[model samples]
Target: MISQLTHLNWFSVLCAFIPYFILGGLWFTVFFGNPYKTSLGKGNETLPNSPIFIAGPAICCLIITITTAMLIYALNVNTLSGALEFAMVAGIGYLVTNTVNIAINPNIPRPIFYSVISGTYHLVGITIVCIIIVAMK
Candidate 1:
């Protein structure tokens, strides 16, 4: 399957990267950062320092990108139909997320504004990635 994606064009590469970077950037930076930090029992202002701090997000984007690329390549999905499939997939993630939260952060509200914002952006990210691949095809 990796071999399949290797034949993708530069645009496909962008499809992989943009969603990961932009969505993760906005999600972590603006949406979930505050609440997530606090949930970890930290103050509102402490920021992660060190090279790992900066690189961690980049690594996340890379992973998501590669994974998305592979999904498209493997499933033979190609549709510029906007948010449908992505929303469904992300919705599935939310269910899994809720289940995991039940075990880990059971006291934390699923309705926490940051959780919603984080999931929403990630949803849009996957949507855009799927749309881009479909459009290119």
Candidate 2:
């Protein structure tokens, strides 16, 4: 499988991954910033300025993007339609299901709201990445 890595278009993968970083910034700051804070009941708390906080999610986003790209290659999803459908199914089947499991746990606050927002974010993000990768490839 290691040799199979060459089959993937790395530049396309990079292009696909970039939007997640951009969307995340807009989603958590410009677009849903206030709403997300309100949902978390952290309306008064300032956004964390620590490098760890910033870098952590950035790293996670990279990982997620890389994983998505790998999956696309592994599944032989090259067509635009296949990429879109596969990405959506993967998002719902994997990401949303896993998130829902965690969100529904009693320990998680605002379980429903949190799941809706975060899950949707993953779905949208994955879809965007898939479209870019397929189109570019």
Candidate 3:
């Protein structure tokens, strides 16, 4: 693990990671904030500014980025097309399916709506991340 970490192209990883985080910010805020909240049965309440609330996602984002970076490296995705293909496969085969399972649970309201919105965001974000990683490589 340490040796692999030493060999990773940090800049490429950063390039891949930043866009995902930024896209998430815009996705859950400007684009689908109200609808997402409504799907969760939440009102227009001010979000807490606590560190866990603020930094938890950031930490999770970094973890996701690291995991994706490792996969890109491991898969030997040296070209833009390969990166995109891998991203699509990962997004659909893993991200979308898992999200759908959760979103479609009986307890969740407007399951399809939430699933579509969130799943699209993941797909787009991962695509952007893969493009950057490949471009930088």
TM-score top scorer:
2
Clashes found in each candidate (C-alpha, N, C closer than 3 A) = 0, 0, 0
Taking the tens digit of each residue's C-alpha lDDT, what string does model 1 give over 1-137?
77866766657767667766776666766867776666445535777668886688677656665666666666666665433575357545753365345435555444354455555556666666666666775
Residue-level lDDT tens digits of model 2 in 1-137: 45546777888778877788788778888887776776666767877778886678778777777777777777778898898898889899988888787888656567777778778888898899888877876
- Give the lDDT of residue 113 in candidate 3: 82
RMSD of 2: 1.8
All candidates' TM-scores?
0.66, 0.87, 0.85
Candidate 3 C-alpha lDDT tens digits along 63-93: 7677777788777788988988988998888
Q: Which sections of candidate 2 miss by over 4 Å? A: 105-107
Which stretches of candidate 1 lie above 4 Å from their native place?
A: 90-118
lDDT of 3: 0.79
Number of clashes found in candidate 2: 0
Note the residue pairs that clash in candidate 2: none
